[model samples]
Target: MEGTMSESSAPRFRVLMFPWLAHGHISPYLELSKRLSENNFHICFCSTEINLNFIKKSKTFDEISSIELVQLDLPDLPELPPQHHTTRNLPLHLKSTLERAFYMGKANFQNILSTLKPDLLIYDAPQSWISELAALNHIPSVLFIIVAAVNLSFFYHAVNCGIDGTNEAYPFPAIYYRDYETKKMIAMSQESKESLPEDAAFSPKCFELSSFVLVKSWREIEGKYIDHFSFSCGKKVLALNLLNVQDDDTKEEENNSHIMKFLNGKDESSVIYLSFGSEYYLSKEEREEIAHGLELSNANFIWVLRFPVGDSIALEEALPEGFLERVKERGIVVDGWAPQAKILEHPSTGGFLSHCGWGSVTESMYFGVPLLALPMFYDQFLQARLAEDIGVGIEILRGENGQTNREEVAKAIKMVALENEVGELLREKARELSNQMRGGGEGVLHEAIKKLKDLCSKNK
Candidate 1:
């Protein structure tokens, strides 16, 4: 149960939250901040100036009170560099930039803490150095993981590196048999000499440095992965359901609008929604291939194609001969950013051709929109497993050695868009899982906040 504070019982605890500038990271932290604020906790929600300005414009932030939203401005560093602002490079740049930004943030945050020393500091995982500050202040520093716990199995494997008789080059599998019991494991492939793909942000180094780690996933939704990977960590491995809102009555109306405008009264399951998160983009060839695939599938789609992968989008030239003209009546090509959550809620949107980012995955499951997982890099391969193995969505097979072809894309699209065998089952599972996400979700957040509070109160 969420605790209520009386004027006399209010603990006057201060909490600081630092999120990476990207929307994906910022949104989840914001949700936690809002909940904490309602419990009378003072919060400093920190992000770069550009993102703060974007939030100022968005309706999401308009009604926010209680929590003090702090904009940590970097006049020298813009959101992205001039030439290489593609989604693949932005995260790398943001991570690098934060090394400097972190210092500035610390100065500002410390100044605030001096007047009122915080009882707790809740930071995103990447903000590792904050743990030292918390230790010095004798406050509790809890690391908040934005991704799923299954993804953190990579970090756990890294921590046991070269332990016992294991080799450093080949880290121990999370799975192992102990003296009296068998250690469970998240089924991740062993790391090899193969380099990480461009989009991967989490690293083993991150896990080694932190004392506490918490990821956003629920045992009810991801019971296998949680039971296997997190059983050893105990309270250190917290499993919380992601918070999202979707209403069936509202969704039914939205679906009707989608079909009336785009699909000519076709069934709700006939249309597909395509998105590559906020960071990814398609090359002209890849875009054309996708366009061709959708056309071949004879499926209506809402494709959110931003600027080309590396440069300005010459959309007309990049498209196949008269492709735009042919699909104008049959498809909705959003050439720039689309309101993704809104689009996903539409009834006509039966499946998602997603990049498999955690935020996208959570959103899909929350809306009961089954996915045709198309992971490009990062933790996406692991994310794809949640859908495929866990039975909430169907995983599309890339070509040999995890490659893709236009034909394969077409087949996958048809399978999901038409509510084919796997699609129907995944859809049913998604609805079942989403129901749990909305219910048990608040209990988890309430428990986390209280746990952090108790840790502070005990030590204070």
Candidate 2:
């Protein structure tokens, strides 16, 4: 359903996209931009230098020459190192410092916007001020949510119901529901305590301010929640899938020969790929528990462990004692990064043990790998629910006080990765749903582009 207009018929318009510093947000925005560029649209992708470092080196970076990756200079804070330009490794409190740095770039950003004068602006949830800037310049804005619709619906419902903290009628279960958004609510309360007008809605006014809201999901995956969000937001809500799936046919896999050989040696559907998301390094106790779970499951695995940048990656100390020697024959523990998409498509990869970040979920499901989800925080818990509801995944249970025990982690792996009736059923359902992602309707993404064009046409 992808169509390329001839030279004479191509539309001429400029779009400026500003995603949050997180990898979860920046990745989807780039995917959408790549889609837009095929229609002859000019794109301005803005992020800090630290955010762009990894992106600039990616293979996809070469695929899209049309996108101008602009690196905005965040204000220099004494507490932060020049290399530490993002919030990836910083403490939770220092996250506020990253926000302050973003606010400091407003003047520079406005100047860039004035010069570019893009027809439309696309932004993320936390930085809704970009929408206000678009309004000031008389350009339409789109709130492109990187998270799932269920999360957004919960946020809108919470604000409307005046349940900022906890109330009896809260939507999710009592334990997770109470802990799900407590930190976010506390942050919102703290922001309120600071100097601000009584009329300020919240930190992220994405729902309240934008003309259009776009989510990286579809009606098939989350129909009822999508409808609920549309009704609550009172704006045009579009749930179109925009994942730029990397294919194995590409020669990129050849670059990582050691990994390819490891996966190639394993039997078909024998190995589980395990990774926590980019953010949130695993605690020592948590890491040891996961290591034990892998040992207990007796399944072949390639566990990708992410440590802090510039830290020495000593596998012996980080993992349990004798863990490397114990599982060396059947398991391989990779440090830092790996080619995720390539490994997921390998025939050996049967399931994914993940942090349930939406981006990772989209990739895992699209490639037909059943999920063993261990959701940590933010929108991840809600994302894990999507997998459970679809019956293609099983959640790793935590304790009453939110402790992830070794036994529960082992059980989840046994259910999904090991050969059993339950594992086969989950894997079969996963393959079926994977096709649903692509073939329900061919023109879904094409239609989304048309709508964006129509919005831009109005401005001209």
lDDT of 2 by residue, 346-370 (tens): 9889899999888888888888899
TM-score of the candidate numbered 2? 0.89
Worst 10 residues of 1 by lDDT: 179-188
Estimate, for each residue in 376-417, the C-alpha lDDT of model 1 and write its tens digit. Answer: 665676677667766876666655544456787888888777
TM-score of predicted structure 1: 0.78
TM-scores, all candidates, are 0.78, 0.89
Q: In model 2, what is the error at residue 160, expressed in angstroms?
A: 1.8
Clashes of 2: 0
Give RMSD (Å) of candidate 2 vs. truth: 3.6
In model 1, which residue pairs have backbone atoms overlapping below 3 Å?
255-347, 399-403
Model 1 whole-model lDDT (C-alpha atoms)? 0.63
- List runs of model 2 lying over 4 Å from the truth: 1-11, 87-93, 162-204, 245-256, 440-442
Residue 35 miss distance in model 2 (angstroms)? 1.2
